[model samples]
Target chain A: MTNETASAYPGVSALVHKHLPKVPFTADKTLTDANITVEPAHFLELMQGLKERRELAFDYLRNVVGIDMQDEGLVCKYQLHSMKHRHSIQVTVHTPPGNPHIPSLTGLYAAADWHEREAAEMLGLVFDGHPNLKNLLLDEDVRIHPLLKAHPLQKMEIAQGIEDRDPGFKF
Target chain B: MTVWPEERLVTADAFNTVDMTINVGPQHPATHGVFRMVLTVDGEMVVDCEPYIGYLHRGLEKLTENHDYRQSMGWWDRTDYLAGMACEMAYCMAVEKLGQFEVPERAEYIRVMMVELSRILSHLMFFGAFGADVGSFGTSFIYAWRERERIYDFFEEVSGDRMFPTYFRPGGVQMDLPENYEDRVRWLLGSIRQGLEDFDGLLTGNEIFVERCRGLSPVSQEQAVDWGLGGACLRSTGLAYDIRKVEPYSVYDRLKFDIPVGKTGDVFDRFIVRMAEAWQSTKIIEQCLDQMPKGLVLNPDLPKTLRIDSGECYIRTEGTKGEYGVYAMAKGGNKPYRMKLRSPSFCNLSALKQMVVGHYVADAIIILGSLDIVLGEVDK
Candidate 1:
């Protein structure tokens, strides 16, 4: 953390803006905690810079979550925290409808391995370079994406013994 | 000296060893819960290990998505069953953050007290189970149980349940503390301190136990961060980065306590760190008791049902295991659109294959025990 950054401890989003001038991302200021977007193509380059750069060294990858955005796409969120500076930020990357492939962070952060596996199994988002992205919390052979908005909660494919290709469910 | 031909050397008999695959248990005792691992050993030294979890998976995230905001509290309590109250605090904090609800000052202090108590409860379990893992038999477990039962009795008085006390609410707590809570908690603190001394004498001070665990599976600070280990596992690597201290939530910022760290990041360091942490938790609870105010425990201004319009936030707490975090996104409804739990056990357990590969098979169990994973949280 620099002198100006240390003095202004909570201006993490400002520091992020200063560091990545070329990348196009927005910061949320209401909670003073921001959500920055990353293009699928430039995700790895930006993440590498964030981890290696001293001012924005988000070395700790706290959590990764996969969210289904219906018509928009599937979203992969990376929650990063810097132990040195004691600041944190969330980075979101979106992939379109059937093209749910995002670059994997397993190589950068070993913590991303199981998290990516869980997200891939639950939301049907494919991690491009994940070494062993298999089903984590679900049955290994079951081909089901349970967390999608379109998936029925009450009548999941695994719940009832009857293996219907489609079941009637209304929310 | 007897001389032999060069050809004789080739026909000489030699000792041979085969790599044997051993299954440790989706049901065995040392596993702590329904966790299974396959260890391939080459003459007592483990060459490879593969851990299989999710035997206890209950689809917590999917279940949380389906239920109403308030109704979902019970399920999170089951995630880290050893420290259910701590889990409740994290869940409630996320909900409160999303809806912009105000928790009372008195409730904040009470919540801190309960969470700290849960921390101690969880740590005591580690001391007991880890001791058994390193070979102290049933004595330490019984010693831990005595203090745990007393704490559970107190929890029963407060929340009417021993293990899964769903006592926390979104804005505050489910109810006020009993009239004699401070006095009772103070008495319980004395017993806990005494219990700690016993564990110190029994396990930490034991020469055999120390020798067995001292330098086993040492992890560097860089390796630990990359592996995403947290709580005592991360602190043992000598980083003073605790969510309570670094990123203060609830009343942790107001209360003063030191984050204990270890220099070597060894198995013994992890054990000693949690022991010291239990002592710190006692201090936090005492502080909370002294400074706590008297007011409504639950927020009186909340409506019959909560309906969040739009919000997104990740609430992280220093849970008994590690950073028990909840990432909640409320698109607009009485229920959250999605709530994902970043459970520490799941992350820590993922690094097991790296930690256990080169050690003796027996030491692998000890290392796994030191990680102190609650499979409920891991499989969720």
Candidate 2:
């Protein structure tokens, strides 16, 4: 990275450095701007700090993206912005192989309710404390995570279920 | 002895009054496009609301992940269908920032002009629809439609399509403005200003419309921020936060325009904030047209296929609705690994339950209308 590019997100990096020294998060530069990876165990603590800290008040939960890494595990990415300070950060939590569970942020940020549901339904990453984690944009009865790498793009072949037939969408 | 029904009270469980659940829209006009909500009402007042979105979901992120960067442009425009060019600008800015490409100065100015026009277009839609919500019926819709049709004709003259023009590319625009485009746009601006004046006389000047919206659903600034409301919703809380003024992307830093804010953050404040913003957008367009340089519209050094070795970033723009943000991750490929949109309507719509729980059923409809959510953006 160039000097200019590396120095862009100083607020995020500085906030992470000053507040969370022992939380097992490294300020990885190669990832997206303000990328911080934490274990599922320390995820809630770190996230609560990020939202509650006065100087680094990351209040608004923007988007939640869930990814399936196949061999590694399932991962959830959270984009947060502070309306007060106008700084942004991305928090990445990687779950274990068999256990794809992470604590939900619906309590901390009310905006996380729908976003967490979308992430859960898309990639099958289970949010632990979410009140409603049922299908959001997909069929209410359909039980599948189509955005996973293993799921094929809909082709000429008919997929598994009966409700998978068309879904009656209008323009 | 005679007893009055108004003073009569039932003890414990005699002749119990049950809470009734009513479903509004998936087809109804009041709920806007394809959105459904189940309202649990106790008599006339709503006690709970469960919003069911996704009727308009097209899996935009999944499709964008599979296609090349340029191929995803058409799909993003459909997200905020009312403001296609605004969505285009956000998508292109994300791609350009990811690839570290340079956009020409002339292209920047043109992009701003088109986006501000889109802002006006979307705000006009709110005025028309919100007026219909508050019982103006066909009058306000027709008044707003007149100006929209003129703007659409101008857009067709430039891009050959009325909606979803897909006119923006990674580095800049698909093409330059046509001959005498300035004269035509200036005429359109005159027409837009006239339309605004008529709307002001019709709705804002009317006593009933202001009376209906003045004190409905008043929101505190802290509550608005916590609920993640954006665009007019946030500004209506008397907070002077606008992405254009706060985080000056593109050529907005060079231009000057005031951020219109509300005093009480009620339904009336939300309505007027957008109305005042329409005037500011006009000012922005005038400045952009005057200062635009004469040069190439597209970058000369762009690659045939955009490929980032490995880079990712979040690009945000002040979309007509709010902070329309795109988070793009490209890891050594032409296709994006993950592309997520933080749509303003989706975040703003999530606050419906909190906003609608205590109001009367009729007032609840007006409150939802005041939110002005596009289902396309919400479901995406």
Query: Pick by lDDT: which candidate is best?
Result: 1
Stretches of candidate 2 off by over 4 Å are A1-6, A30-32, A155-157, A161-171, B1-15
What is the RMSD, in Å, between candidate 1 and the native fold over all Cα?
3.2
DockQ of each: 0.43, 0.44
Candidate lDDT (C-alpha), each = 0.88, 0.86
Each model's number of backbone clashes?
0, 0
The Cα RMSD in angstroms, rounded to one decimal, for candidate 2 relative to the true structure is 3.6
Find the 10 residues in a row with the least total lDDT in model 1 chain B: B7-16
- For candidate 2, the lDDT comes to 0.86
Across A3-61, the per-residue lDDT of candidate 2 in tens digits comes to 12234466577777697676778666533356788999999999888888798888877
Fraction of native Cα contacts reproduced by each candidate: 0.51, 0.54
Per residue, candidate 1 scores C-alpha lDDT tens digits across B284-329 of 9999999999888888999979999987777888999899989889
Q: What is candidate 1's lDDT per residue for A1-171, written digit by digit as tens?
A: 000112333377678778877766765532324567878988888888788889999999999999998999899988888888777888889898899999999889998999999999999999999999888887788777889988877644434446755465422
